[model samples]
Target: MTDQAVFPRLASLAGRLVTARGWKRLGLAALAGALATLSLPPLHALPLLWVAFPALVWLLRGSDRPKTDFTIGLAFAIGHHVPGLYWISAALFTDIGRFWFMLPASLLGLPAVLGLFLGVGTVAYGWARRRWGLTGWVEAAGLALAWVAVEYARGHMFTGFPWNLIGYGWVPVLPVLQTVSVIGIYGLSLLTVLAAALPATLVATKPSWRPALAGLLGLALLAGWGGWRMAGQGLGDVPDVRLRIVQPNIPQALKWKEEAKINNLRRLIDMSGAEGWDRVTHVIWPETAVPYFLSSDSDNPDQAPLTRLLTQIAPPGGALITGANRLATNEAGDYIYFNSLFALTQGGTVVASFDKAHLVPFGEYLPLRGLLPKGVKAVAAAADFSAGPGPRAVSLPGAPAASPLICYEVIFPGAVMPREGERPHWLLNLTNDAWYGQTAGPHQHFAITAVRAVEEGVPLVRAANTGISGVIDAYGRVRGALPLGDSGNLDISLPQRAETVPLYADYGDAVPVVIWLALLLGIAAFRPRPT
Candidate 1:
């Protein structure tokens, strides 16, 4: 059999296999979703998405009603997100004595909520296809567009959790991931959905090769361009700055305890001022490294102890940037508390500070504060954390000006860079990954942090309370790192930033927006003529 002859026959067979109804359809949908999650980080089995996305397209095609399509999509999403986000339950385990009962709820509840977006998107796909009588490549394009629309919405709605997006599946493949430098992650996600879903075009009634072949060609072009961009490029020259990332691997349970506070502070101190500090210019501690308020507070006797410890470890003529909590009195005469990044000079004075502008909902502050009970608190801290003005790049002695991202703040694309000032030379991310334990959370978090470097054409220096602490150069390569769940310090030179700002950095979401609009137009312009 020739090449053209075999594909149609295979597609016809796939159509027959995927057209089952009732429990069989639901089961297949769920299986496809579970398989798709294997493609994400820590697994990166990307080939599985070939089977999963086509299965989703086939399921959507067979549905006669929007409700049925929605049900199938919901089943798929639940399978995908539950396994993908099961690591979230690890956070609840830190204080198992208090939160043990919430384990199953955390695992099952969050996925169900997130799946609603996919469900609604599928419903829209069904409506568009049925209303316009779409088929073959047009149907595939429509479904892919709808799927990405939902993904984008989920990424922006209600504090926005964009974890495990399909684009991250390409992370293990450097040439493929380089696309983000031009179009950002969401643009790559759009292409991923389109390519994966196009296989279903072969199974459509028309059985046209145009869409599937086009998708393959597009992917090839992407890889070719990326290969050209990265060809012959090695880690650029190291800058004048050198850093010591302190990963004490402090347990979340012990991080805030009064009795253990001194030990935690001492651990960071000893690790920073360790034997190798004589040449290091800057030292970093993870998010909330200092449990007590370190800013000047005459009324609080803890200030003296805090200053005494920091005085010993502060680098000569350099600064120590660490995560801490700060307090300020507003004109209303009320105290506002913030999760912040403070830069302490050798004299023990905090010369510069960047308060975290984007606060984590529920983790830092309750969303519906009035609705909750009086004494209830957020997960991370006892009191609610107030949001700061916005992003700021702080200048240190020897290091280039740096933008500070605290904890989950680094995860947001197109939102991490400072809004007004000159672009920072490097991104300084301080996070406490200890809350999530040794599960996939830290690994996934580190993966997202790596993407930011490529998107901005700048280096990223990430310090985590547990591990995955490292320096990633502009190309998203890990120059050096401390292993997850280990206590150690990495002494490394900062890699130089890419010479030019990335296309995505300059244009923001415009790339993805243009792609989405073009796909939508194709669906409309190519509607099938009367048979």
Candidate 2:
């Protein structure tokens, strides 16, 4: 009844799992991958990953040919991404009448394209293992490394959709989530895949339970280190910095209606200037809250209404930082439209502003418009949005210098901070999550936003039109908040930045890349010759 003796029996069962062929193997692979999606946000069922990854490892063992391995990996990845990203289709439902044709494309087509990275990555790394009849820890390490490699590439390649990384599974556990401040997300994902997959070693020819024990030890060490880092921390608040985040919970369909535009602004003003209006020093609004162009400072017929609204919403000495559209003539006399964050001080004086540097593809601008069939248009906006130069830290009246991230721009980890100037005191994210209302998209988006605060060692303040608005201190703790689909405003004191910048902020993804290379080297050194 010893550990070594029991595990060989597991090897026999694993052999049966490996013998699955054709339709049976494909179904099991897809099922395992689909189960893994539950490990993502709003669910965060970490134990499912234990089941999913080990099953994938055993399934990968069934095939020796590259074609067979690639297909298995493809089916597995397709299953994983479709469920994890199913919320994407909720945006189409905002105007379902026009976009009904895109349902299958959203649910199946997108995942099919994105999943190729994982499929190819598996074939590349798993090749050596099958060739040498590798087993035990070495084989598990190979699988773990391949998963992280694909995760990294999917995040960086082709506009890069890096949603639901394995690391985010730790978000529900604060102590575990703190690990991102050190190794960054990719490194966290590397350890996550490694720990989760190591149990598969129990099914190796010379099976031993020690590998599973080691995996548990890895989790314990990670938790111990994270617990220590967060141990005596308080929600360090800054002086004279109070913020009001207004969430009107407007529907995406009504947000841009010409008739409802004035009413929308009034709703924002009402929530912003509600009960505790006198005590608030600054007000924040979600992306595209105004819906109409708020004219520049110079005398124009449209300027009067903007000034009146600013007087109603702007704090006495502070400013109102809200999302708006900016139309300006370039040096060549061509008009450029930008999705932007503009700060209006008391008396309607325009102070500081930052245009969104990273624009969302398809949502902001189509990649190759000439290639697409005629009459097709970008889904999110009526006109294509121009990109800003890059990240900028602009000074506000009563708040610290802030870097503005509009909508999906906040999702990118290393790119949120200013590139050249002094580091901003805080991050200001304005988003309208109404596009994917009442779904996991907003919750997942908010989760990713919190991680950036920890990774950059700065407090983050978020305002969303349809909720998940909050103030996150430097440690990623939610100090103040509102839920999805809520109509309200939260009055919160701006939390102080962490005393020291995080290592990941200074080094970026290089921390994880180094760890990946080390794992690759170790796996190669320990490889057994082909049997």
* lDDT top scorer: 2
Overall lDDT per candidate, in order of appearance: 0.83, 0.84
Q: lDDT tens digits, residues 81-181, model 2?
A: 88888889988888888878888988899888877888897798668776665677888889989899898888888878888888888887877778889
Model 2 accuracy (lDDT, Cα): 0.84
Q: What TM-score, computed on C-alpha atoms, does each candidate reach? A: 0.94, 0.96
**Where does model 1 exceed 4 Å of error?**
1-13, 16-18, 296-304
Tell me the lDDT of model 2 at 427: 92
Q: Which stretches of candidate 2 lie over 4 Å from their true place?
A: 1-13, 295-301, 529-531
